[model samples]
Target: MNEIIQLNILQFSLIYLLLILVLILMKKSKISQSKLLLLGTFRMSLQLVLAGFILTAIFENPHPLFTIAYVAAMVIFSITRILRKNPWLNSSFRWSVSLSLTLTGLFILGYFTQIVIGVSLFNPQYTIPLAGMIIGNAMTGITLALKTFHESLTSGRNRMETLLNLGASPKQILLPDVNRALETALLPTMNSMLGMGIIALPGMMTGQILSGTSPSTAILYQIAIMVAITAAVCLAVFCSLHFGYRSLYNQRNQLNLPR
Candidate 1:
């Protein structure tokens, strides 16, 4: 590897030109998402630049507290993002999502950092990146799960009530919806896994290879991280749905879905 070719400011600015293609297509199609596209691009650039500086500092001076704080911040942000994405959920459902994401995210993060990766649990270099990937995927998975669950339940509200009137347990009535949501949540990760080497070069593997890591070693890390991401997604989605559906009812086992 030849010292990791550096991208100068001018060179880096050229990447933004690619967005022009998207803008042209949107304009031709009369899509009104140009503003969102620009805003997303600007925010992504700013956030990644800030993260780069912060990560540099942390990498230079690694500390357990720093890593833990970063992880906690990520969890908080993930919860906030999920709630913002799902404003229609009840307070009880919000609690369920927050708890499920926090618990499952941290649990898997610990396991991956300490056991699977065999790195120091508090090593910022490894833990921060890995936690971002793990928590980020879990957040996306749970968001999709909640969306699917809400849609399915809302559409099938009459059927749910019929089941309840027929003496069906809450579990019995909600199991199908739960399973559907879980499957929806896992599908993206599963599809990506299926197309790993054939259709795409995933971000992690590409980053590692560019940084001069051997292709074989990068492949191993990529595989491990994908598996970890899928596991985290499953656990987070399952926990959210498992506890979330119960929130639809009270002590009397009566359904109280939001109107």
Candidate 2:
């Protein structure tokens, strides 16, 4: 196996060239996101640097309760993002989203780390990375699903109210929208899986191979992770969406967009 080289600060600094190219595109095209793009890039770099330090500390300590607490914090932060995207959702749906993320995330993370990877629950190296992956994917799934659902609900309000007047139940009125939202959230992962080996190598597998792990081993990990990600995202989005759709109905079973 070849030795893996680590990039020094100057070497890594070369990445700014790509950002400059992006800025140039924005300038030439009169696109208005230059400020936000720059800020987002800076924010991403800072978050990752801080995450490195925090993960190192956690790895050094490696207690089960500490790991659990850290994972819980990640879930909370993810759900906050979800709520920010769906600000009009009622409190019940917010809790539902939180519970859905936690449940699906922990289940997939546990199954992957404990069964597939044969690691202890508190093994910081394995647990933290897997938890991060699970939480991140689940967060994205719920966010996209909720956003799509909200938009569909809003844009189809007249149609929905018409159906309600026709005595259609919330389920009848919202099922198509729910299905569409779930499909939107799941489509990217599905497409990625279809193209994984042929078109694009997934990040985890590519990282493993670059780090000198065998191709077969990396492939196995990627396959397992993709399956786990699909399941987690599906379950998380479904749980949250199911609860969320119910929030569209008031106690009298009339359509009420909660304040």
Candidate 3:
């Protein structure tokens, strides 16, 4: 077993103080001139502590059912966050995001685990963290795509209406906006993957190397993760846009703008 290096109270306090100093600098730069710094830090610390304890308990027991349950909880929590972030979205949009994220994330994760790696029993150590990363990224992509689509539809309602009146179908009128939104959602992932090793070391790859994995092995994992993220993001964004279009049009296929 790797020796667990513990941070003394004084060290932990100094680390937190450094974080606060960084936040203060950020505020001074007008990056975020709100009390959100303190609140966000507090929430982050609390959540991390709670998650640490819960993960510790799960790691000790390490049952398959428990692992599966935790993964499901992560997906559900992520979906709920997506819905909360896009409160204006209808139920169908929410369900589509949930379904897309779960299906895409699970498919990528399952392929990586069962076919690529082929680990026996699907250990929680690998599955949970990997699934969390993929699902989290997918959630972000879906949310961004949906938000962009909704904003574009609402803002371009007049243009869309004109197009519809000119005999354009809903899909035709919306495809340009939907495609743009999906591209916007995908740009960050694409850029990160493209510039990964050249620009900066990714967190996962760095952590893997720090934890004593070989560079080759870490690179392989990083590649797999990047591919999975791309696939999941594309799937989630496409699904969100496809389902979100329904909410923007009425029974007669006319664009509905909220007055």
Instruction: Judging by lDDT against the true structure, name the best candidate.
Output: 1
The residue pairs that clash in candidate 3, if any, are none
| Decreasing lDDT order of the candidates | 1, 2, 3
1-259, model 3: which lDDT tens digit per residue?
3544567888787877677677778888888744776788889999989988888998898888888898999999998998888887766666777787887788888887888789643578888888888899998898888777778878998898898889998878988998999998999899888899999999999888877788899999999889988998898788777776677677788766443
Q: Give the TM-score ranking, best first.
A: 1, 2, 3
> How many clashing residue pairs appear in each of the predictions shown?
0, 0, 0
Estimate the TM-score of every prediction.
0.97, 0.94, 0.90
**What TM-score does candidate 2 reach?**
0.94
C-alpha lDDT of all candidate models, in order: 0.91, 0.87, 0.83
TM-score of model 3 (CA atoms): 0.90
Q: Write the per-residue lDDT of candidate 2 for residues 140-207, one digit (tens) a residue.
A: 99889988888898899999989989989878899899999999999988888888899988899889
Tens digits of per-residue lDDT, candidate 1, 3-29, equal 788889999999999999999999999
Off by over 4 Å in 2: none
TM-score of 1: 0.97
RMSD of each: 1.1, 1.6, 2.4
